[model samples]
Target: MNRTDLGPQRIVCLTEETTEWLYLLGQQHRIVGISGYTVRPPQARHEKPKVSAFLSAKIDKILALQPDHVFGFSDLQADIAAALVRAGVAVTVFNQRSVDDIVAVLWQVAALVGCTQAAQRWIEAVHAQHAAMRQAVQQRVQRGARRPRVYFEEWDDPPITAIRWVSELIDIAGGEDIFPERACQPLAKDRVLADPLEVVRRAPDIIVGSWCGKKFRPERVAARPGWQDIPAVRQGHLFEVKSADILQPGPAALTDGVAQLHRIVLAWMDGQVAAVLGQGGVAQAGGCHA
Candidate 1:
């Protein structure tokens, strides 16, 4: 088949997920422009002209690229999409909030470019990986491993909690999200902890911070007033998951992000068991004395 005969021969990806997906689909040739924030398939930055950031774009530069189609994410990009649409450029803005939505968007993008079968195979592989992780968690629970309470910080200043997909991943990774109710809110503002002390009250056993592009500072978190008493703080159970890994709301989140979460949970469980044994208690296979 002639390459141009497929839909959207020349495309612009305004987000990392679509760009990463196209690359994984062996359709990178179609991408003429990409987001500056793209780091997943790092070579995309060197190979494609960066025409957009997360919330802003160089409209004239994007137009110069003459992309037949532009892919973006979320209502946050509405203005950019509108500008491009007014200029006679086709745009698709996907708002995928959960793991299922991410998978669906992956299929939609693939099918649009005549790669449905390829996408199907990739989706199957993703499902298998997810299943393996779930099985591991189930076995751990069956062995009487206590699931730790996890508090995932998306932003530090206002202390926003995990999104829906992240909370779901934590559950699948053998940890309970402390602010699961906040995860249900799609908007970051809606998930904001009006009082940061609420996190102290929640007393998460593990704290994972991915402060959206900024490095996570454990000391700063530990120093928060009254936070010292939290189990995670007292036990030094704080960790960092990079924004690019867990905050992307795409394949990266499903794969690398979830894997990291699982590792963190498993390590914590092992530590709990060791703590019990060190205290002269018999280490029970199905339960931790600590």
Candidate 2:
């Protein structure tokens, strides 16, 4: 369909990343509604009316808006999409589970809106940025000395770890994620650490939390039982990376999340060496045995 004839002049986005991507591609005029939780770009909140939330939506309200298309993310949104579809509104759900999948979804969305050329250029630019960042991280790892084990917490109640894209970002940043095996699982239950002692056993050198739309409580994490013995806690390596910066599964995650990971890992590595030299007057520190 032509950009003018795509029948999506009134669109509703169920997630922040899709809304942000459409805005970036100059398709904001087509968006009629957005998620209540969208904070990215800042302008989206002011521009679009909030009609839905992640995993749940006001179906009647969305229908009243007369949106021709509804955009949602994941199986979590399947019901929302089905409801809209049953009401004769077209819906597209993206279930991107990896960094590559996210980029591909962006392209697909752009294509749906007849902005394929713009999407191609945008993808190329992001790919170039990723390559350059990867190279820089590799150089830093080779020269600056060490790689740390990172434990990335996506939630804390049941203790969920990083998802696939987040784990990949950690790898790109020159750090190894402690729960790499669980990264591919989409459900929180699959990624949750059943035993708090598992975290203690992993003994990560850095613990980063991004509690999925909630503010991470590092102090709360630091106070967990048996966590006092974890090296990350002892060295004050516990940190909070905002959910917007990492959990979005789009350009924001690639840019801001990877940068945050690199900064934290590099700082932790430097701190370890500094601590050893300060204590023993020697630069040698058995450099990141992880």
What's each prediction's TM-score?
0.91, 0.88
Residue lDDT tens for model 2, 1-290: 33734646788988888888888888899999998888877898898899887767999899989998888888888899888888999999888888899899998888888888888888898778777767766776688666889899877888988899999988877789999999988776788888989999999988887777666667899899999999988877777677777788777787777876777666665664333221211111110000
Query: Per-residue error at 80 for model 2, in Å?
Result: 1.4
Model 1: what TM-score? 0.91
Leading candidate by TM-score: 1
lDDT of 1 by residue, 1-290 (tens): 22324799999999888888999888999999998888878898899998887879999999999989999888889999999999999999999888888899998888888888888888898889878877887777798878899999988888889999899889878899999888888998899888989988999998988887777778999999999999989988888777787788777788888888888887777665333222211111110000
Q: Which stretches of candidate 2 lie over 4 Å from their true place?
A: 1-7, 272-290
Against the hidden true structure, what lDDT does model 1 obtain?
0.82
Output the lDDT of residue 144, model 2: 61
Clashes per prediction? 2, 0
